[model samples]
Target: MLELGENPDTAYQKIKQLFVHLNLPERLWSLSPTTFSGGEKQRVNIARALSVDYPILLLDEPTSALDETNSKAVIQLLQERQAKGSALIGIFHDEHVKNQLCTRELTFGD
Candidate 1:
């Protein structure tokens, strides 16, 4: 918190919101993420990446491992990030996800 120049309370609130949005429970916080399921780990990675309010975010298959419900949650989070003027660049195999987060696309010949 001190290193990031963010207030502890404010940081906590941001993380708390991510937890709720990502469906991360308090119990999982104490345990190592190595024990988590694929979807759980994906959410954890999303949480970690969003924890910092960086100007640019590089995402790859952020929603690939998730089901429709969880994928919606992840897309919501990405939309929130994009709304804040973050430069998001990523590879999204899901057409819906790509359409949601990307403003432009480039494709190589198959």
Candidate 2:
């Protein structure tokens, strides 16, 4: 949050929004994410990343640990960011998510 030049209050608000969007419980906010479940921790990570404002985003399997609902929410957030002119470079095995978010496709080694 500080790294993004956001004040503490703004960071808190942004994190709170992400937490709500990702369905993370507010109780877990005061604790270390290491103690959370895999999906919970993943939500924390995603929230942290999305909380920052970046021109370009690089994500690897962003929804791998998320369920369908959470995945859809994340996709929606990413789409919103894309609409705002953020460039996303991601590796997603979920073809549906990839197709929804990507305007162009790139393939790697066969």
The lDDT values for all models are: 0.89, 0.88
Query: Where is model 1 more than 4 Å wrong at Cα?
Result: none
Q: Score every model by TM-score.
A: 0.89, 0.92
Best of the candidates, TM-score:
2
| Candidate 2, 9-101: lDDT as tens digits | 988888899899989988898998789999888888888778877899998988898899989988998999899899999998889999899
After the best TM-score superposition of candidate 2, give how far the Cα of residue 72 lies from its true spot, in angstroms: 0.7
Weakest 10 consecutive residues of candidate 1 by summed lDDT? 1-10
What is the lDDT, from 0 to 100, of the residue 54 in candidate 1?
80
lDDT value for candidate 2? 0.88
Q: Model 1, residue 89: displacement in angstroms?
A: 0.5
